[model samples]
Target chain A: MNTEIQEASDILKVIESANKLKGAEEPSGVLRGAQNAWDLLSDEQSQKHITTGSGDLNSILGGGIHCKEVTEIGGVPGVGKTQLGIQLAINVQIPVEYGGLGGKAVYIDTEGSFMVERVYQIAEGCISDIMEYFPYRHDKASSGREHLQPERFLADIYYFRVCSYTEQIAVINYLEKFLGEHKDVRIIIIDSVTFHFRQDFDDLALRTRVLSGLSLKLMKLSKTYNVALSLSWIWRYRCSNKLEVFVWLFFNDRLNTKDMQERRNIFVGDDRFCVLCNISASEDHDHLFWPCPFRRSCWSSIGIQLGSHSDLNTLISGVKDTASAGLFSEKLL
Target chain B: MRPPAPKPPLATSTYNQQEPRPEKPLLLLASSRAAKLSLGCPLLDRFLSGGLPAASVTEIAGESAAGKTQLCLQLALLAPLSPLSSSSLFLYSDLPFPLRRLRLLAPKSRPDLLDHVLVAAVHSPSDLLSLLSRAQHHLAHPSRSPNRLPIRLILLDSIASLFRSDFDASPADLKRRSGLFFKISAKLKELAYRHQCVVVVTNQVVDVVEGNTGNTVAWSSGRQVSPALGLAWANCVNTRLFLTREVDGNGGSVKRHMKVVFAPHLPERTCEFVIRRTGVFGVEPAQRSNNSSEVKAHGYYLESDRTRKGGSNQHKQCTHTSI
Candidate 1:
């Protein structure tokens, strides 16, 4: 028993010592000590924004893309999510005197859609914008000419091409060590984080988990390293929500009613009786449009019989066929 | 004969060091008090006696769309939210991971919960084996992983998929497949034991045809469905939870049921749950009792045939009421 007690104590001592060494050896910036809200606010005030090169865009974005935050840029394919990513990669390197962050960028291309030629052109455009805007001082312009070269802008941005999701994860995992060595990197851009993820996945739940995991890691990296993490993804529309919006816009007057039974819970009213036919049945989409006695009479008077089906497409197509057949028969006679 | 290895710094080496370890009893005593990871739902966690237990393999077997994947995803998301603030490793061998559904389930405050869960896709048995081996190395060297928090939860979405397509039913093939299953489970058990991690593996269920009485699984959703991979694979898991889904009486929504088929600590139990956009929620006990009583009054009752030797049949049966 004595020996056991001594061994336990010895193990505990080793554990404590190992924890201390781990704490001491941890890299400086990775360890984020607790800070109050006031400190956080003050830090935000001191944080710099990388210019997006458009004045109106900069104004709306609160002086451009703020550092120490992960910003997701999403839009429909070809709406220029990648373009914005490349522009930011170039614009992040704008020199300090011009009120820019004056830091390099790390661009991770997952889609292989990143074009070096377009990036060079954007870099040229950025350099020209700087010279035109800050040409008040002749000496400053001359001295900054060398720094404003397009090639120099291109050189400052490090590009990594990842072919698969696994490669994407591996690159992201290596980023911490990379950032430690290259502190000048002010921004990291993943050109379409959803490419390989969207394809070849048999299990959708796993995809969500994997993508969420990646986003979480990116968020931590941005917070710890004080760099702007920009992630681009194919802007997705939730089909149900979008379809509902469209249907509401087109058929709102026909479908939605104040005394409708579906709205009874919301209005707390007793008038759920069908407004068209006073058969005392509750007013709903089916009762109002499909089976209502009044609606049947209206259709009969128009010489177009209606079916019991609730599908609007079939109903409309049936009506068209009846009308056309009647017109053709009249002409044939 | 092994060569002497170089010593790591004393303070940095304590937690992971294998030699000079504390006595077995002391280790067990400390681990017994160690916190279990929550299943996210309060009631389910209570039913699980805290949450998923460490150092054991738990299998969740269910048919398609039975919410097995959703339950696993919920666990992955919840592991980080717990006070332990530990990370998880999700090994997906099935379909594309559902990022949108997970986002819907994630709480508003910590949308970044996904970041704490590391996910890897394994296409086949060999791929899964290699990944597990590599994972063992990564867990041993905590510095190698991206997140600071150690992985306390390792979830394999479905174990049956990797083995289902890769092997034929030939006797030799079956033997090889069972060997692989044991190898995979052993690796998972080792990792769970060494890291004190909770290992959860989801499984696919195969329908049991009538007249085939050989090792048939129980009935769920009025149809006989049993966990796939037969008895050989069943022996590897420490605990088994079966999920079943049936259309509600109203016919608008699905009512999901989870039952503990076997576990060392937990009793044979069953519960009703619903999957919402927020997360999976267990039905309250009061509501559950009321529901069962109502069903019984309507001449219906849950038939859980416990008398069967190897397994029990759990299904809802209804009797006609003479009006």
Candidate 2:
């Protein structure tokens, strides 16, 4: 084998040895070490909770979102990302075993899309079957009586709106405080994280910095509260009518290189970046994943294989199907 | 020294003052185990695990005129009057049908079924969300016995219509539309858990791009691909059944063909059903003789060849039945 393979093999051996050592430690010592680590990681005890969403989706996400991690869902317009997030929040408030966390959800709507009517629709959809099997009991009996009501289930969801990035941060902070006081909030949904940050930060560096901060904050909240933090991302499109021969030439030059270097290392100066102008537009989730040439290029840089059906809706459906079937073993790529 | 021992003899009373406890009756024993009711459609019930598992979401999607609303109406009428003693409720939002039509469709339905069905005409996505929350609130603490059958079913006919842009305007408005739907789905899941009711949502299908055809016919071919919500909505649902039209050689009329396109535990296959005046009926063909196919293929020898020509309408109908 070549030196690279040899070196990789050596590293693997070292990792295996380390794992063996970790496994061989005295049980008491390992327990003590685990306790110490847990103590150091928290100022207060963290409560782990799950959101009561669809069983398939929850199972695929490893039993709902993990606390202290920002699950970013990016899709073109009308892919149902926001709707899924809202449903997650509501589901979190339900008791476990019924596919819910039995805790409250904090919904932060950055784009002012939260609505109450759809909640009823969801409830209606959920109970349509039960009603079919057992009709209202009052009609068959001599005793005048009634059963079943909807108010108890609606009490679990809490909604909020954030107009700016700062406001979004404030909401997270407030959620942390609220969680501390009442350890029942298990899910946090922020609809459309792109709207606030995209408008204010034009420079790439500045945008990355802002996004990094926001992601860090969301991560911290997730871990600290043991709540799943789900955020939605809006997709942007660029349409180009004119074809430039230089674009293909530049790409070919990069492809001809012997060594595949990191993308960051290739940028020698700010002016070296490729430029393409004037693009048309259409809005849909498929555009965000595969159809959009710009996004496809970006994703390719990160080593993600874009599938033909890479739209947000298709992905969600695929995941849900797998999750429900108890076959969703792959991690989020 | 002494343990003296003269213990006084206890006096034995012959009369028992306490009355004998009566044996507990076993009259209600069988009724307790019969709590769960069946939907009567075995295949559909199997998809729902014997019946819709109480307190869960079951989503149903199909193209336009795909019987989604019709099934919802049928379930609404059938659910509340189940053989099981559990109580039920049906909540509908943004349905196109009038109350009178629903009443006519379910003439045999119990009057209480009508009352249990909470119908709301939602004009916007936001309003639909509010209706879900309200229904949940009512289901949790009905004015009846808490231990009795609680609100059992929630039916959302064509959830996609609520997200259509024609109902709203502006990016802000679209966001609100989708956000509201998200929240509603979440709440319904919760309600399903608390009440052990099943949640069913009907969805509409939009055209989506199929593949790179490279065809360039103006007005129809340049950009022939359509758009759909795609993965996002699919991910949220636990089960998804796609209903479509299937050809029936017996008659030219349309028949409902349901396929378990995406489900956690169910096999992916299609089943056929017909819509009747009462409700959806699963059609099973009668047993046929081996020669029936040959007779059908030949369209039966002409009557003139055997006995007579120009058979009467009644005779034709009888022959058709025989075939």
Candidate 3:
């Protein structure tokens, strides 16, 4: 072969070897659009999970709530979907030494169900539980070594009560920025996530588009941030007090005047019935929630068996700070 | 063992055959089976294999107070089982919010989930029909709607309640209303399939008299109840579940039976459940196995036939030993 040709071929070989070395450094240029599986495995952010205390629940969830995912809780009215939402919100606040996620909660309340009094009660219960059993654990944070006030949980929780659908959309849209501002926030909870979609919007087609956008945004947020987005929605159904009481009291199925009336012709509204029980009393929240003879009997079953010497007002209203109050409020929420 | 044989010269066609390097077929990453939302109730979740399948219509029917509404609420709460979506639309016709009763029945679940539900009521069938179209439009998009499932659930508390109230309306109008009803169901099915949202509709049941219990046969059961909506509505559902109360002779349901009457994917079977302050659960709380697929492989269902099963018996034995 000619000397010139040989020299040119040698240069080509050297350039090819250099290119192969460069390829090994990055591998297929995939680094531009993708990542190395080894790096992904070690990324750490994708593996975080926030646990709900109920083992049964965690088991069904694959691994509790994935910190980098959205978890939705769906249920009908009176099914305590919100109660679980609140439970997780409060459970997330537990100190890491006590088997909690040990982070603050962001609660978005749309249905007017968030009770601050109820939150105080939950915090009190969680704190007492921590103080009682968490001492022996390695958590110096809660061993009176670290000055962490129990009430600090309440302060750490960021709550947004968006009364309208627009407000809800606005808050969710900018939640990423908010989370960036608050690095300590671990969970974002929207109590009854679907309230405004049903109530405010007459344009459901538009609602679906908007909802789909929000869902996509939430999905993206979960992927990008190390936070769990938990949504809880209540399925409220219209039921009369008479049927409810009968189902509670008797174990048989019998058609009532209302059922028969509806079966024969039309379902007319009956307002005189007590909202809580069919025991023939005026329907109201205070009566239904606490003071009624039936409600009092139910409360006694919980623990603080309101003794004859105990005042109902004190037991119902003045009950706070005590263990019984914590129990009551915890159960109430 | 020996010197390598002289290599044969490549045929002219060997390099000319246009051999392109094989590449991994553009991977279409997606769920092997359809994506589903968990119901959060193990018995029910297992019965449906992790919850309601997306892009399908699930009809829940039962007699009044048969806990049809309760199951709906459970699904509404369980929609969070889908990590990405948080929207649930609960359309009520005329029922009041039984908050007090719910507090008792659903005591353990978080109280805040109720706040996220979007609730609307329709007084008439037309109102319901319009509401459904509006919902459809709300989720519609100009381009291909998002591939990710959105609007976790769209519920019609009693999709047939207003239709049942059409008894006093003109026969011709009732016919038109019933026709419109089918349209809503069709539109709902399309939305479900397209958006992967769960569309659940609660239906009522009517009583049917059995062969008469004459004096000669006084001990026999007298009546049987069946879902009310006729064949037209039946064709629209991907899953039809029948719920009934298990009365204890004192006029109360000690338990409820959620029977899969029919489904495109599931066979007929019934699971017994009871409503508690913690919501609806099976007679036995479902003990979750870490290898969920192993449990599913054994069976995601508790079939009546399994009482006679052979392989399943060994699984039962394994469970006992594990405990």
Candidate 4:
């Protein structure tokens, strides 16, 4: 017993001495603080830069969502939420000069709304001007023409459709394998998360529980991959009226009795309807972002104010100018 | 023939006169042979330094029928019988098509390759995790050394399907799903490092808003939000390849064209390949000329004279084309 006690004391002494040596190796006051500051300054430039498919959107989002954080875009149908998600994927994959990421994008479609043909159309529009205007062209003989085939553009985009929750998990595992093999992916989009959950789990509590789990997973993934993640959602019925009113006010200068009457007619008696209300609003991208009543409120709620009845092109231009002005003002100040 | 023993330590406070030696640096023996086993495509094999590095994950993402699965199938069939060493293993989980289709696709693949390839029809993420853990155990046994048995490649087909099917795409659900995917990928990376294997996964794309126009049309529609799995999968991968389809103008007769869109630490350009009867092979330079009238070439042609004998190498070189 005496020997055992002595042995225990000896072990304790060794441990204490080892710890003391470790502590003594570092001078712990101002030097430690200086070390931390140096580390922070050195690593600041290497921080991840996320590109939210849209230039205006990226500006609003402060250079896209931070890597490994969740950013939700919720609105009624035809409000450009899904469109924003898809654009981000393509833009994220594009080179930086084109106001894109030049990184890979992963997309999971839950609402059966992901259309590959549309992506090609957008790609054609985006790249055509660049190809035509760029003056640096070698001789036709030296320059190979076959590489610009539309099929080539289509091949750069990846697509997936999910109809159930189980398939969602499978897709996740597949994504894990993909990231393991290829590490340049920087953006991920999920079109309308509510459909899968709404279809599979009926109970709200269980649904939220499942959603929380998914949210945490995405957050971790973004951090691990250093990628920006965006999720689309369909607003529930409780928020539909407010959305409708908001849209009505944006389209009509005055939200008087006639506009309310038109809104009433548009909404009708259908309590859970995802209808296309304004004919003009449904036509282009500008109307979808700033004037589309159903989504206008969402943008405002997030502090992105929009002018009444503004078209998408004008709204984007306005947003850009405003953002630049803000930046310029900050620089001046 | 034992050496003479030294005297015991004395209770003295004096230090030794000999100088302290610096610790030997840890030397990792990265095998070129192992890398060659993972990349089945000859052009890709050469482009990616023989093959993908072991202990890292690679992502192959694309739309449906964009040849993502076909690529996976090619790797599965080629990994085990690769010239690197004997007794390599390939694992395929959560495949969309039937296992029979994989067999049919690679009919000419070696019988031994099929024998070593393990296909698991996983229904849930938990099941996949459990199987992966078991695989790690099998690969990590000390008895399984380099010359004995080497598990070189692992492939997971259609990652989006697995997560999208099980979790709602709600922000909350996506976060959770991505977290789980990140965890699994972390485990796979650890396993790869410990066992010297390459892990590959395939992902699907989504439609979102475009950046310039804020439009949701097919052309303006961006990409789908990958469930948390999508993001997590991207995070853990060491390289990423985005695949997309295009119309091959075979003199007005449209053919499906598959090209690589993105890869990390790789050239940011596209390369064309076709999944033919023999398997995924690079299109010959002669065939490429036929399609040359459409657009200027941006990426370097991955033409191998060794693979295609008596093939013409004349092709126009342009690096400005955006397609």
* CAPRI-style class, candidate 4: incorrect
TM-score of each: 0.41, 0.39, 0.37, 0.40
- Please identify which of the two predictions, 1 or 2, would achieve the higher lDDT against the true structure: 1
Best by TM-score: 1
CAPRI accuracy category, model 2: incorrect
Candidate 2 segments whose C-alpha is farther than 4 A from its true place: A1-333, B1-37, B83-89, B93-101, B104-112, B145-149, B165-176, B209-229, B247-251, B284-323
Candidate 1 lDDT, tens digit per residue, B51-169?
77776678899999889989988998888877557888999988798778877787888867878889899999889878987887888888755656788889998899988887889
Q: What overall lDDT goes with each candidate model?
A: 0.66, 0.48, 0.56, 0.50
Per-model TM-score of chain A alone? 0.58, 0.47, 0.54, 0.50
Error of 3 at A139 (Å): 63
Please, what are the lDDT tens digits per residue for candidate 2 over residues B112-231? Answer: 656556566766656765676676677656767544455677777767765765645576655544444445555565565445566778876655445523211111111222213344
In candidate 3, what are the lDDT values of residues B141-194, reduced to their tens digit? 422445333465888878777777765467656556555555565456556644
Tell me how many clashing residue pairs each candidate has: 22, 79, 67, 117
Off by over 4 Å in 4: A1-333, B1-34, B86-97, B107-109, B142-149, B210-232, B248-264, B290-323
- State the RMSD for candidate 1: 35.1
lDDT of 4: 0.50
Candidate 4 lDDT tens digits, B1-323: 11122222111111111111111111121242234454566666544435555555677766676677777777777765676443434444444455675677655635555665666676677777777777766765535444344566777875667677878868888766765665566556556544556678787766543342331112111234221243335444545666655553455322333333333223344455666765676554345565654323423333234332111111101111232
lDDT of 3: 0.56
- The fnat of each candidate, in order, is 0.00, 0.00, 0.00, 0.00
